[model samples]
Target: MSLPMTCRRSSPRLLSLCLAIAGALAAQSAIAADSSAATETSDDAAHPPASDTRHAEHAEKSKRAVDLDTVVVTASPLRTTAGDLGKPAAVLAGERLDEDRASSLGETVSSIPGVQSSNFGPGVGRPIIRGLDGPRVSVLSDGLSTEDVSTVSQDHSPAIEPFLADQIEVLKGPSTLLYGSGAIGGVVNVVDGRIPEEAIENGFGGRAEARFFGGDQDGTTDMARIDGGTDRFALHADAVYRNAKDYDTPDGVQANSFIDTKSGAVGGSLLGDWGFVGLSASRFEDGYGNPGEPGDLSAGERGVHLQLRQNRYDLKGGLKDLWGEGNGLRFSFGHTDYDHIEFEGDEPGTTFTKNANEGRVEATFGNRDAWQGAVGVQGTDSTFAAVGEESFVPQTTTRGYGAFGIARRSWGDFQLDFGARVDKVKSEPDAMASRDFTPLSLSLSGGWKLGENWRLTANLDHAERAPVEEELFANGPHIATLAYEVGDPNLDKEAANQLELGLQYKSSLVDAKVSAYYNRFKDFIYLVDTGDQWYWDEENDYLPIRQWSQSNAIFRGFEGEATFHLADNDSGRWDLRAFGDTVRATLADGGGNVPRIPPSRLGAQLRWENGDWRASLGATRVNRQDKVATNETPTAGYTMIDAHAARHFDTGNVGWELFVDGTNLTNQVGRVHTSFLKDDVELPGRSFDVGVRVFF
Candidate 1:
């Protein structure tokens, strides 16, 4: 309960993270008092088969501890497994999520751990959890809701497509009971199974990839995918293309940063054993540039450039064990048609539009000894417009509805979960004002299993939100976050309360987890800076004036991860890892700080594998963000190094991989105080990437 002496300052790395979280809470309280005296002896249940033969020889060590056989359906509406989803989660899959696919999904999940990345460049990025990001972060695709407007700002860009992800979870804190209220600062599901619910293995399969990148913005990418079936029918397809040019910055190249993108998709499904149905269509196109302006003017100079597009359509369905054994049902629907245009250096300076529709339905029932859960209904409709001359938020329409539920239960090693939700939001603006809100939410979580390698978890939440449309109708100049915006239509409705705690460890050679969180807000809708100023002419003169405000806030954080197995036979294996994270937002009455937060980090990595070679190396440090807010400006912390290598090939029927990657590699000059173009972008210098991939 401190901070606010101009956001104080000090650190020996936060005193070594408070002596490593007080030596991991005193070694988890001496291993929970030696597992409660070995479950009161008698060889613990007279050796219930020695814990079922150590769970059948570690059942793949509990899916390699924490990777618990990846099966998350966004924090539960019952797809469970991620250690039963009691919050704090992360998953980005295979080939390290395809070599960290990046076309900005906030630089492809920004290396997990409490995540970060608001770096609006390299074609707009977003994701900023822990300090929250626009519309409180909920970006799904494959679980619906991606009616993009990119939370209405931050240079947009979030039309889903992290190289056609096949996995990308990340459901940190406060997930409004199952994705509503924009997940209240969490949820980033992006699984991309197209539309096949199941079946399509060996009936046919496909994938392809190509990549290239070299320093100062050189780039190229290509992708392809396919699937097939006939157990009643199934099919899917995908495509992508990309180009880049303005990157590089050890002080150079970033001018009008360039990019051009493309996307495609197709789908079909109709199988059935119990049920399945599907449909799909997709398209996206991009043409970027808007390095927040700099250098050489002409062509009617003025700044801002964009050309985006979207066209989507989808329908989904599923059912299984109909009204009995694990009864189930699932549904989804989507439709979108979005548009963007903003060139200013060459006419057409405004034009935004969207036409969206969404739907959802869920059902599932008691899956056993105690209970399992799911229940749902969701809806949305949108129509937005912004016409010429920097139109700033009007001509709009929005609607939403929600109903949710979640449940879970377990005995022995204990486990519990709960959820609830309600929502109704409306906003109409064609002619200026109209608003409505009805938010409600709740959640609970728990877990325990303090032996067999430790575990403990807890979560509590209460959420509510409704205010978007740029916080209720933004009003002017937005030179890409240079600010001069305003919005407030009597803003209200935003309540939050959260708490979390976690600890986990699994053995077969060591693996770990640790977490901490706290949040409390009530009306906390920020964006301030009213030093008043707005004249945007005569060579970009007046700018400040940020508006959109509210008060009472608080945020707290901690994150952790660890891994080690430094050596495992058969000619290959060696690993080591470490991670860290931190957050501290304020203004719960003592107004100070709480702006672009995100500082404090620590990292390490080392690896080497065999069976088709692999390699890795890493380093990270970042930690110099002087709290700030009050004419904010304080950032200076750095240390980065990266490396990678890969190789694999089978060619029996198709399989291959080749890679190389490196970044920053000693050429620093980084800046990303959670970026608003951190004083004119810089972050990406000394780069290299080379790739290839294929599978069948």
Candidate 2:
């Protein structure tokens, strides 16, 4: 089958992707033969000597196992596992990731403790970590900045497609030691495996999936990915498409809450004994409505909608044994062209554009048993512009350079880790004097094994973040936020001193973890309600006046999760899990509570797994939030119920999986306190998602 003529005419890139898919399908037969032969050869080579048969069996089992603690975190330059890391981290992949996947990146990972989503609507959801959002948190794609303008506004969605990700990693605390000033709060990295780091064991492999969402949301999503290559060279391609109509809320249908997205990428790599070199090109297009400003037809007002497009190119390479047997060097570069248009009715109201280039190089040395460390340098150059009626911020250019080093040492049952980073950042506006900031960050962490089943960890972090473009120069009205925003050009960099303590216990019957953290900020930047209003003659209304302000503040939080292995017998393997998180933020001088902080939440899940079938049922309770900043109203509490089930089987030489996911089963009227449009927009109503996946 081929794409329609209209699809072919829509964009050359789309046409090329369609052709690539067709080509991949046509070569499946030959690829299958090669895969079969490769598998046979591998099986024959797996035979071990009788003397080492038991050890070889154990090694084989480990190779085929997928353990969250054992998964290597690609975000870390040292390539360490989550269990070995000095700080708290979470990895979502395999069946778990598939069950948790959502349309937005924020929702996809919100289940993790200490993390939540900032929802403008169904179309826009950004990750918020430990009461921090916007510029504080860094969103990354394959360890590099996504280079999107999401931080500039609450209504903008990230340019990444979560459905295509192979694994998503969340670093829960201050990660500025590795990711720079933007990660003063933390980091979220989506690994898509677009650029293969190693050869495909099966010679050729791919997966395709199609899903439909029913109930409050009527949507369809389709995606496909293929990887093929020899020991010397490899290729990859992936594509995704999604469309959804206005979703229904408890009050009624969300008038302007629709979404449409299309994205695709192609990558290739050259592999050898030394290392690998790879390059990839990707395109993303999205169109979504702003429910906050739903227009009235009687008043001749048109609903607001946004159209976004981005093209990105990435190049990555690595060299092994550079200095010694255990030493390696890696480098990556990315260039992105991004633009978005906000439409008022049928006319374009505002246009935003960004062009950016970023690069990073790092070298790793030593071994994990004794001492290991990594040193890296990173640089970024970006230009941003806004024009048209709703333009609130002026054109600006930002340049940043940083160098960082991290080292870890272990002795017996004790481990210590330390890191430091220094950065120089400059922001130059079109007609204003440029601002420069020099920020330094340092961190120290230690972990000790208490016994065979218990462990303890502690961390101290001093991180600094430079003000972003919006925080330092934004001015005028932002319709999406319904506010007249003002900025202070003389704003200084923000600094944070944080401490964290954690404990863990693991056994055959139960696994658990708990952590507590506190942060003190010397200069915290936040949007303040000035008790003033701006009267717009065109809209004949007064908009709230908000100004960017700085003050000393403190944040404290606790997060924990535990799982109990209930039963593992003929019926199936049953596991019960419980998780909860709470955070409090307020001014150090008792000025007021921080606005838009996520409410406390407690959740539990019952999961069952068998040979080829799995299922889960869960519920979360969100507590009411009354601790609000001046002029901010309180939000009520809510309870959400969700469930999932899947069946796996094989057909001939191919594998197939059928899955169903139900969210908000009770159709709760939940309001996200962290959202700018919380009062105007309720969470989507009950929805059941049914899907089928095919593997080759």
Candidate 3:
């Protein structure tokens, strides 16, 4: 008799080795409990209280400087500051987010440490954290899943609007207990006010921004947001539209690289001292082309266009001090309908649709004795289908339920946190056998404040994930990836054991943080090329044959960042910053190195701020990636320089900013190894954008 693929056990040697390193580090310095690299949420600073007219008037009199410590809601069910969490976390908002905004969420935050973008093109991209992408990483809107088919392929985009977001949070390591199975890699949560949590002040406020970008290609973008309310009622609305033409490469024009996207949302809420209730409706539409290789055209297939659409309805409510002496309740529900069509010239090729609904309720208990945390239950149901040619996976329906809790306690100069979750999942394929799985996840972490200037933090987590529908039923060609895929129905669950250690230093002159992590997996599910090719029709067009398989794997990485305040005087402030990140992944069973791993990168920046003007000059260098799998090739790296300058003006009721941004200033031809289209498309060269934004 043979054993199953999944098993539960501990690696004593690896555990002991990591524990020794952590112990040594703990002896030298106490680690900070929170990361110091995040910026504060700008909404509280941008909008004043409506009840205090005096404060509102004073706020308009003098603008406040942005804060570096911002509150984040994704770390736990209860909102906590980014610096209070035990993981390496980052926040993007206000001026920083706007300056880095792009057509895809992945590119918008690619500069963050330990994060990389899997750019399919300007039309589709997704985040890769550490050395993990695809099904391991989870992308969320606010706190719920986007419920899109993006995870099925690299060419599909997440059905969410990034331009309307007020803030974006990135968690760099295992955050499984809070979000659930797929978050073993990390979480990217996009926060917006589509459903108003609080009433807007001053009765009315809004902003409108427009931008024009040109390089080898040209693009235009327009966005608008508005919020207004009485003391107890609020209304919010936002919209964004973008259009771009085919981009140019060092060789010539990359064919069929155009994009068109539009999104809008409307929301209303009732607010009071006891909390608030709100509801919202949103719609998103995207039409884009897939830029294939110049000579990779098939009979009757001149061009490929994808038409994607989504409609979502959300309801949220909360009650403070309701259940117990110091308890509160918060509940949220969302329903999403999504569909996409692949069009080959004037003919329809394939149509995909997904319908999903999710609901969650949580209760937070205040500090009693020494423990404080929240408990919650979440339920989700989804149906996915594909019709016409290239329908790889059969129609499938998934139902899931989970219960989770997290608690924290403080003792002397040390803080300890613990969390646990259990989930039940069922996947039913119309033409295949039904599969059921139960996964359990847990986490433990501690932070020791080593005096006033330094701190040390350590965390351990165990996460388990069940196979998704595509991994269990796919049995056809996926032209988007240029591969024929086969799935294994008897595949078992995946489990990961990870450990992380971090150190932080904060003072008047310098702010620095460094972290290292190791993860070991059991029954890791991955797609492996079978070294066989399948021909498409009678044309002899062929693709590699790949099969979903299970193996043991390990990934390890380190990342660090530091900022030094060079000068702070009445004239202005000057700062110097440096950051670097790298990761190595391999199969423990000696299969080979993992494919498409991002190359190591190092960057430095010199920045200056004086009154209404801000300027920065920076350079980044990516090292060549020589680590290759059996079926993959090596990729060369390159260096890039970028610059930006902006000026702010106050015009009575409106404040506006004029900015000019330059990328690839040196005009270096670079290829991103993480991109599926790296061989067919070249990264944009020497681009410049001049834009203006007005807020009133």
Candidate order (lDDT): 2, 3, 1
Candidate with more favorable, higher TM-score: 1 or 3: 3
- Residue-level lDDT tens digits of model 3 in 177-236: 877787888899887777776655445556656667788668867777766665577788
What TM-scores do the predictions have? 0.33, 0.93, 0.90
Clashes of 1: 1
Cα RMSDs of all predictions? Answer: 23.4, 5.3, 13.9
lDDT of each: 0.76, 0.86, 0.78
* Candidate maximizing TM-score: 2
Candidate 1 per-residue lDDT over residues 165-247, each given as its tens digit: 76688788778667788789888888777786655543555565667788755887777766655557768888777887778
**Candidate 3: misplaced stretches above 4 Å?**
1-65, 293-302, 323-326
Clashes of each: 1, 0, 8
Candidate 2 stretches greater than 4 Å from native: 1-26, 35-65, 297-301
Assess candidate 1 and give its lDDT: 0.76
Q: Give lDDT for model 2.
A: 0.86
Clashes of 3: 8
Q: List the residue pairs that clash in candidate 3.
A: 30-455, 30-456, 31-455, 31-456, 32-455, 32-456, 34-83, 40-70
TM-score computed on alpha carbons, candidate 3 = 0.90
